[model samples]
Target: MRRPRSPSFQVTPKGERLDSHFISSLSRPFYLLLAITTASLVAGVWRWQASPSMHGAIAFVMIWATLDLLFLLAALGVLYEKPQRRSEPRAWLDEELVLWVEGRPFRARASDGSRLGIGVDIGFSELDAATRQRALDLFHKAAIVTLRFADGKVLQARIENRQWGPRQQHLHLGLAYRFANIQDERYAVDLAFGDSARLQENLDRRHQGKSILGALAHIAVLAVIEGSKNLWWQLRNLWDLAYGAMGRTLRHGKTKELT
Candidate 1:
């Protein structure tokens, strides 16, 4: 296996590092989309006003502009979301680790690691009901576990966090190592993070994104839901006022007849 590179970021000309620029980079495409949408919308409106016969063109442009605008706004929402406090850079890994929990052995894949902690993925369905319960119990007690790698390396760490989340069916286990000395700490760091090239690779992979159709659909749905809410309230208020006026008119007619 190639040695991991050190965790040093290649800074941009704007003096922004990877950690700080990640969010803004995600919004770049959204900004482009919104600009194109706005230009198209203005042209479409101008054409409609000049010809009045291009109703179809204007209608299509309007719908496209709405979806694009909403999607861009949704992207901005994520871009400006509060940042979470994090620890040291974790090197991504996918190697088998033999986890010893209370003398019992369980198989897991080491997913990522830092100097102080490592994350693993375990097959949730592979464990028996009793063992699954025991794993949960260990998490609550901050259980110390001994894990062995395929290369005969071993480490004793405390199970600091456990999350039973969806990943084609796997549970995430986070471990914080209990090092006895500096040597142990150095060994743990080298074993987990290597040189840190994997961490940078992971960051690069995040930038090579997939399709945005799902995001557009999601934002469109939210916009429709919010607009419908306001429409419903306005309609309800109008109905109440109209009903009250009719009732008052009927009472006035009855009083006139009696007089």
Candidate 2:
């Protein structure tokens, strides 16, 4: 007899569903439009074959369907501009952690983490310019960092990169692990990819995207506004050139008459 598979190895339909609900919502309209257009075009061709007198009716249907296909293409172009989140699993932390840089401590929160590295947002609220600069410089120099977890586990890491956001409100650091012990490595792995469901939920929340109609409307409005602006500028430039040429022509005519 064959043995039953473990829960972890079992296949679940829900788990294998489409990546995002918004993608389904956006795609349904395209599929529906394509189906309708194909049916209409096919029917028109069939009717025209049966009765040649129906040529005008078939031509009208063809034109209408072609316009709809153009609209569908425009919708797709707009969808391409929408923001897409990374598919890689990541764990985000709500509480802050303590990071020791060259014996000086700074508070930072774990923004994102993977098996490769951890990204932190270090706050510089109470520190002065020189102190903040010192901290940032230390982090940039690839110095060793000690992170203290809420559970009292200490992990050592080295800075991989650093970035400062808007007005230097906080500093972002990308830290690579320099594990001194086995427990720390295991803890980091567990923190990175241990909870797949939790990470998926976080990803889904970021993908709260617009529906098909909303996306189409947004694209249409922006296109019209931008097109009008370009048209106005082009016409204004043409008018300026025409006016300047006319003045030059009149001046030349008078100069020739005087000569």
Candidate 3:
């Protein structure tokens, strides 16, 4: 199999080294539809202003607001979604390790934004203890990141501080799609939960789903605020017009009485 050339990325011959979490592809059509809806609403707004139709402006506002919300839900679904990994439809692990040497699985350059991690697939339980220990040594030397599977292949690597309070640490790895022969078997791996503080972090994550979800929540709030502003401004304009007419009537009546 042709090996991957980058340190942070591992490419299986059959499986794609997907950058997206899981069902990230599902939102493409959703976002596209939203974009179209948003554009149409904008065009309608312009036409409404030129034609001075209250009904047309109201229709545009309603359509734009509803579709914007639907788009939010779609974004949340796609970004935070994760699929079963082992059942991933790729047949790359059937062959035994050709050479399990202690080396960078792939070459990586250090970037300023985030710390890079090295990913190593550990499916060699059949190998002796010495070899297993040696395989782990490569991860230690460069202070690179690794995803150590009990028998699971290299899934993915991420940029993390790799600290778990005073002693243990958390591993930030990417999810991989491994194709297994057994059709009935489900692909799942238990992720570790760390210290009390880390436990809180995990709990928060569980409630909110993931980082992507948190971001989505923030975005949704902003959109709501903006939509509220649009509705409020329309109401304000009507109120001002009503008050102006009332004041004009009172002044006209007083002038007529004086005359």
List ranges where model 3 is wrong by over 4 Å: 1-28, 55-201, 204-217, 221-259
The 0-to-1 C-alpha lDDT of every candidate, in the order given, reads 0.70, 0.70, 0.43
RMSD of 2: 15.8
Report per-prediction Cα RMSD to one decimal: 14.0, 15.8, 22.4
* Residue 208, candidate 3: alpha-carbon lDDT: 68
Q: What lDDT does model 1 reach? A: 0.70
> What are the models' TM-scores?
0.52, 0.47, 0.28
The global Cα lDDT (0 to 1) of model 3 is: 0.43
Which candidate should be chosen as best, given TM-score against the real structure? Answer: 1
Q: Taking the tens digit of each residue's C-alpha lDDT, what string does model 3 give over 75-125?
A: 544354343333233211211222222444422221111111222233434
**TM-score of candidate 2 on Cα atoms, chains taken together:** 0.47
For model 1 the local lDDT of residue 74 reads: 60
Q: How would you encode candidate 1's per-residue C-alpha lDDT over 1-259 as one tens digit per residue?
A: 2446755566554422233312344655655776787788888778888878889878887987876767565655556423222355667777898988777778889888878888888775766778677766664565788888897877888876677776324678788888778877887778765656765777798776546886557667765554344334445757999999999999999999999
Worst 10 residues of 3 by lDDT: 108-117
Error of 3 at 180 (Å): 30
| Predicted structure 1, TM vs. truth | 0.52
